[model samples]
Target: MQTHARRALATFAVAATTGVLAFAVPGAAQADAGPSTVRITEWMYKNEATAGEFVELTNVGAAPVDLTGWSYAASGGGPGQVPLSAFGEVGAGESVVITEAPAATFRSQWGLDADVKIVGGVTHNIGRADDVEVYDAAGTLVDQLAYNDQGTGTVKGPRTDGVSGEPKTAAALGANDASQWRLSVAGDDDHAWAATVGGASDVGSPGTSRFGDGRDPRASDGGDGGDPGSGAGIDPHWADVRINEVSSDNGDTPVGDAIELVNTGASDVSITGWLQIDSGAAASATPFAAKLPDGTATTTIPAHGYVYFSSTKGLGSGGDGVKLYLPDGPGGTAGTLVDQVSYTAGQAGTDEGTDFGAGAFARCPDGTGDFTSVAFKSFGASNATACESPVTDPGAGGGSTLNCQPEAPRAPAPCPPPRSLPRPGPAART
Candidate 1:
């Protein structure tokens, strides 16, 4: 099956390059039932003043796509058709950027080295509204995307000069729908480029993976055949998955600190190639490269299912921050952040230094509620509704209390006793 898919893609690429290919617009009836492998993954109509606009294309098929005389056209705008000259080929699971800027300018601005196509004298007027179309050598319409200031299905408004537009995960088939499109998130490295380009603070991710939370074109639905660097094709949207609970202050014990995550979306989510960030001074500290639970490397969380991760890194009793990051590329850079939660020792009327010694903080409404103090530790279970009330511990000169609801008449199940701290060596004690 995989070999057949690659052959079909290679045939299509040849036809496209030779100008003999007859392709229909998406949704049109076709003799063949298979979907097109090459897709318009992303586009930036606007950019900094100095940088030229660009459209990114990705070959999701199993074979490389040849581009000899392809072109981009706008149905009802100036610079009607920008013809693409010989630009070599786009390999399987690889991306090629078509830009109005010279090759050098585009590379320097985006920090891209290769796989760039330059079309001089043709400027893309994607300002407020435009009908963008991709054509093969024979002028066959491969794909068409229309956007306006009024917006369409999932996209809220017109794509301004600085921001790029991308489709949502599982919504690639509905690209024209306004609601399916979203704005790109600028990375920390983009700040310098934004300054040089002289546009908004948000710079689009070009020649890279599609920005925002869209499906990874390079990823397989469940299999692992694509690039090793690309993450398992998981939806990178943080909203789909979240940190539901945290047992950060596990009574100063190394074994009790655990982090829980819940999938709130309708579909299953993969945590493959994802990382958990632990930042704070505590009994347990975050690991340098902690991978999620797929047994060996990666795993998936079924819809509405929960996955728990325990950390040896002692979380700060007073305050600590936890972050989840998606793997960006093979270089080990932190990709898009999936979700983050922070806790302060004394905020929200909770006891100051003593809260860490008391119990865990949980979210009300389970998967989608605000974090609050819980008297009972609900690891991998539903959270308690009532907040935990703090009491002073005179022996330790601090506060300590069993996990119990403040208003509940009866105490809930008590949390396991705190593990004893390791005794100091004889030499160290001396």
Candidate 2:
């Protein structure tokens, strides 16, 4: 489905990994809170708009939750903290959004309902690999959402459905692990990227879903009115696309991470309006990484063909991952997960291009096989399989960049190296 409306909200982007948002000194973990049964459900850390970023909470429990004296702060220390005194109370099964944007502006941007309980005053900017904490009047921590690096150049955490999904719009229902977290699309699911509005790459729906896509989950004023069963707003490409190869720790080619995708189906695929999200790269900035600039060499993947994506943003050398979302035209919903691939330091050859995965992870046999470490990254071409001979370039220091530190050291060859990547084995039927 194409975007049904226009989204003007924008998220702020981190220009560089300058260690801006720091971790707060650890304190005793707090869990008990009052009557309200709430959990931190969704949040986007890449608040390129500063005001556009937000955190969503849902009352899954039976009782209404009052949050008069509650405070919102980052476990990962960032901007000033905000007290929830202004938010009044949140009814059962309802959702409320807390953001740095002025309440009116936030409401207008996401097209939220007046009764949805949108509030400003959040000085805490969500950061990569950080925690969102909510404390009660008595200073007792009620909820702490520890989100691993899902996305920033786009953000999603593990959905109850599959892979570590981005938390940008992760939907979690009462005690359930796997929930139908809606795909981030622009048509109707999420706000479409725009230079003046969301700064491109921005995808999320704060105060949108109350934990589920069922019509019943939308906020009090009446939900976004999407028909859940029909799958109205998803992009068709989501069904045929696949993330074939990703070069995150690109010390070998240091030209930046190169994402190679393939048309798994027999038809061609155009990725003009698609979104690319990065799992947090503490040392780099992925601001424009989500979308490609004008005149990119290739945006269409021919029948069973490959399109190499040269990213404007680089992946973390130590460890980082990449996510691919289906395209959404202007005002179109675009966050249907097309494919995603991630890597660790050792498995990724670490940032310096020296580790087991050799800083590159690929789908052996190109588009059909499960992803595994390859001899080296082969963008816009067939995947360099582990079964192939080892070939580290002499120009970049003879020996393979092998420093499996924090783990065991690795062999100098990508030829049949240990398969230590997380998403190993057969790829999930994404």
Quick one: best lDDT, which candidate? 2
Tens digits of per-residue lDDT for model 1, 186-211: 32121111212321122455554532
Q: Give one clash count per candidate, in the order shown.
A: 17, 32
Please report how far candidate 1 places residue 280 from its true position, in Å. 30
Lowest summed lDDT over 10 consecutive residues: which window, candidate 1? 421-430
Query: Best TM-score goes to which candidate?
Result: 2
Misplaced by over 4 Å in model 2 are: 1-29, 32-36, 46-51, 75-81, 111-115, 124-131, 137-139, 146-198, 209-242, 247-360, 363-372, 375-430
Misplaced by over 4 Å in model 1 are 1-36, 47-50, 77-80, 116-121, 152-160, 187-200, 210-430
